[model samples]
Each structure stands twice: as structure tokens, then as C-alpha cells.
Target: MSGDEKGPVLQFATFQSSVDEGFWHGLSSLKLNKLKTDETPISIMGFYTPCSNPHVSSHLTLLAESLPTEPSDGLPTATTHGNRNKCSVPGTLYNTNTLEGYQSLDKKGLLQAEGKKIWEDIRSGKAEEDSSVLLRFLVVSFADLKKFHFYYSIAFPAVVLDPPATLVDLRPASEWFTLEEAESVSACCNEWRMSSLTADVPFFLVCISSNSNATIRPLKDFKACQHEDQKILFAFYDPYHGPNNPGWPLRNYLAFISARWNINKVQFLCYRENRGFADLGLSLVGEALIQPSQAWQDEEHVPKVIGWELNKERKVSRRVDLSTSMDPTRMVVSAA
Candidate 1:
């Protein structure tokens, strides 16, 4: 099908960030922008515990908050490097409160619970029932996304797996499209398996949580670079325990990209760094700025790590320009 047929699929899915609604704003409220060029008619199952009062929708309202990001150096604080203290993620596209909400849910069993339901839905064909509750995915931007490729980042991979029979359907805070499921729905993932995705639209399913386990494994006989698209579809597993801080994790990310082939473009939105950008193979990097009107949790300056091939370097670039960097593209990657 063509744009004339399916209409123009959204160029970006901007999950909006707002504080007035507080933490549990529901998936619909997270949306920030919509392209008005083309028109298409659009329209959920039970993946969340229902709450009539938005004020007390879930544990987010009770446990999470839009904490501020702090300097890793120069600034001093008694706060430790964990979720128990104040924290926030960097980036204009982020919702600080929503991230806190997600972090809170990770502490609970919401992710695992929602993962099971999502798997059940895919197996039973009830995906539309809980569509509204499932978070909307858009091409807001991400680190290291390349032209003609679909780059994926699994910040928290637990929710994508079907939980053990003992933990089936626990009514988690939200449901999400899993890694395997994402492959199932994407034409770009033909290496993963056959596709069941609706043919015309692009997909970007994102989730962030404070959950980090050393035992985490993202391998399923599928690798990020193995996309049928033959462009560059890289997937990263960021299990950083401390929020905002990027030293250990960012160093690891730089090292990880250094080992990969042709991955030169990188962008990051972390809050903390133990060393200067020079430590991460970045040079002459400038702060990527964002508008306060469009700011989620603005950082003083966003830096680009520059140089991935010459020095086997992985330099971060400016923010991802959704216009060309990301698309469901012609690359046909698939799922099981």
C-alpha cells in the first residue's frame, strides 16, 4: 500500500510530557505532536488496573516524581547512585514524571505482568483491545540511529518476555510490544521470522525503567545488525542501574559501539558523567540545545562523541533528525 492508500504514517511519535496530570497520565496523554499533512482514521485490552480518579491512577502517583538531574562532578550531594534518591533523564522528548512513573512500575511487577498480557494478546489476536493503554511509539529520536535503518534500544527488556505460568495476568501498570513481538510486526526483521505487521506503517516501541539486572540477556537468535534491510539496525541493551549518570554505562556504550562495524553516529541524553567527554572518545562536541517550550528535562549542553571508524571511535551526534534518520524504511526486518 502507498501513502495514498494507508495515508501518511506519522513521521514521528512524540510522547508528550506534562506535570499537571502527574505521573499516571495514561498512554493517550503522553502524545505531544501530530503531523497534519495526511489524514487517516485511527483508534485497547486490559493491561492496567483501572482507576476512575486520575490523581491516584496507579503506584506512580504514590511513589514516583519528576526529580531533577544533577551534575556528576563539580556539584556535590549526599544522594547515592540509585532510584531511592532524586533523579531525572536528559532530553527534550522525555517526560521526567513519566520516567519516574516507569521507574516505580519496574520496582513493582508491572513490566513482567504486562509482558505476559502482550504475549497473550499476540498469540490470541486481542492487540486492539488494550491499544489505548499501550504506550504510543514515535520517532522522537535516539542515540546512534542511522539513515535507512531501524535502531532499537531495550532499556528494560523484562516486560517483553512472557512471564512464568505462576505470574500470568497480574494486571500490570502498562503493556508493551516485546522484542520478539516487535520482530513479528516489522518487515525489516525478516531474519527474526515471518511478519504479521500491518504492511504500511513504521514502528517504534520504547520503554524506560530503573530496572537493571546483571543476568539480563537480549539474545534470541536475533542480533541488531542482522536486519534484512541491510542498512544498519542496531539494538542496545542499557542495564545501567543508576539514573542520569552516564559514566560506567556511557563508557560501556562507547566500548560496545567501538566493537561494532560502521556505527559512527551516536547521540545520548544521560544526566551524569564521572569523566569529561574526552574519556568517551568524543572531541569538539557541542551541547545539543532544546527549547524550553519543547523541553522535557533540559540539560545544559548535549555533546556529540564524534569519530567511530578512524579511532574505532563512537562520537555522539546532535539529536536525531526524525525527517531522514528513522523510518520503517524499505528494509524488511521480521519476527517469529
Candidate 2:
């Protein structure tokens, strides 16, 4: 309870990028036919599901369906609405004309640019209205159609906390809540998850009354929830199965809670699942202490972004070559 006695700094599990072969094929078609020699930033969607298998981490996946059917007009494409199986997150694709251009690209600058959008969304209540915008991503790439190779780097930018959030306590949701409260919360969360209306909503407010009656509300209702005497916990569909750390999304979620609600002390729920069902044992409950800075109020100030994915402990672009399988001539040679 003492802010002076800092607990362990919060750590977040980073997202891994997975590009489907179909995505590359679709990009090839778009490049050859529609986007010839163009280096414009195209709006794309990335899909990810909650971590069901603890052994295998969930990835931010780019499939053929992620691309727009028509040319992009610098706006977000359609989302995987009402689909709990696949949550669609908006992203940008900067397909460079040449590999040199991709390599020389300012990674930090690009991350900050996207990070600023997230900041603006949090400031303007857009994130509260549509929580999906908090998951914006960037992929800078160079597709070599000649060789059927693709070089790209993905970044899931997170707004950096100057002092960082401190963990007050962390435990399984079952341990944190009373048996009655847990039951009520589980039932409420299942209803929210099963409903086609709110299944894909990644962020929400969980209100628990003194009698242990729990209800889930959208993030936009934060102001209303504040007036209620019920205990409010910021909840999100956590895509991590780590024993201790929450997922990357919490970084920006914390920022939104602090900036919008002016809540320095936060009680949060990392909602995880087991085999598509709510598992309070797998879920976690934690209290975080955040010291919101006044500098965040400045419209011009951009918080430091901190989500470039590491490749084998180093920050670098990953290359994928699909010539043998995708190329007709290569397939013929192999078959012969």
C-alpha cells in the first residue's frame, strides 16, 4: 500500500509475428497488379487469439484475408467483428520498393509515429469507445517477387511509462477473489465472452458489488462505473500464459486508465482461458501502482515507445523465403 516501497517492476510478454504464405501471395498479386512500384502505407489487419496452449505462444498473424479486397485509401480495413475465435487488430504495411529502403527506414521514428496515434486515441476517448485501436501495429517490408523472398520487421508499439508500473500484488484470480465473487465473475465473464456483441471486445470494466454480484461493462462506461460503490477492476483479454507477467497490451491500457480516469492505483484482471472456456485459475489478478506524469498532458509530447520484437535476443528484421514451395518453376524442378 505504500508507494514509497516499490514492488517489482511489471514485465509484459511480447507478441511474435507470423505471416501466412497466403498473405505473401496476396501481397504479390496486389503489388504486381494494383500497387506497382508504390511505397504507400496500406491498412492491414492482424489476427490473434488468446493463449490456449501454454507451450505455444499466440502470434499476431497476417493472413491473405488480412489484406483489403480493394486498394486502401489510408483507412483501416474491416475487422473480424463478433468473432471471439479471431480478434482482428489494425496494422499498417509499409512495403518498400527496395530492400535498401526497408533497411534504411527509421524504425524508431516509425514506431513513435504510430505510438502517437495511440496516445491521441487514448486522449480523445477513441480508445475507450473502440479498444481495438490500442493494438495498432506496423510492418515494414520488402517483398522480392523475383526470388519469392520477403523481408519484414514487425513492431507492436507500447507507450513507455517513465517510472514504469509497480506491481503491488499478483496472484491467480481464484486466489484473489472470494469463492462467491469468483463464481459471479466467472458467470458474468462467460456471458460477455459468449455473446456475439461483446466477444471480440478486448477491454472492459468489471464491477463487483459488496454482495459479490459481478457485472462486465464496456470501457466507455468507466465514468458511470466510477459513481457506483462497486469495486472496479480493469479487465482485458490477456493473450499470455506466463506465470508472472501480463501481456504487452497492459502497458497502453494502464496509460489509458491513468490518463482518462486519473486512477494511480489500479486493480486489474488478466483474463485468460483454458480450451476456449474461462479459467479463473489460469487468469490472474494484480494491483499496479502508476505515477502519472504531467508531461503526458502536452499534445506535442510523444511517450517513448517500447515494443520492437527481439529476434534471438537481438533487434533485427526476420527474412522468410518461400521460393521452393510457392514458385511454379521451383515446384516443377522439385517434382521432376
Name the best candidate (by TM-score). Answer: 2
Question: Which regions of candidate 2 are displaced past 4 Å?
Answer: 1-4, 71-79
> Candidate 1: where are CA atoms >4 Å away?
1-112, 122-229, 232-336
In candidate 1, what are the lDDT values of residues 257-312, reduced to their tens digit?
Answer: 22222133333222111121101111111111111221212322212111111111
Error of 1 at 139 (Å): 23
Candidate 1 TM-score, true structure as reference: 0.17
The lDDT of each candidate is 0.21, 0.87
- 158 Cα displacement, candidate 2 (Å): 0.4
Which candidate wins on lDDT? 2
Instruction: Give per-residue lDDT, candidate 2, residue 333.
Output: 96
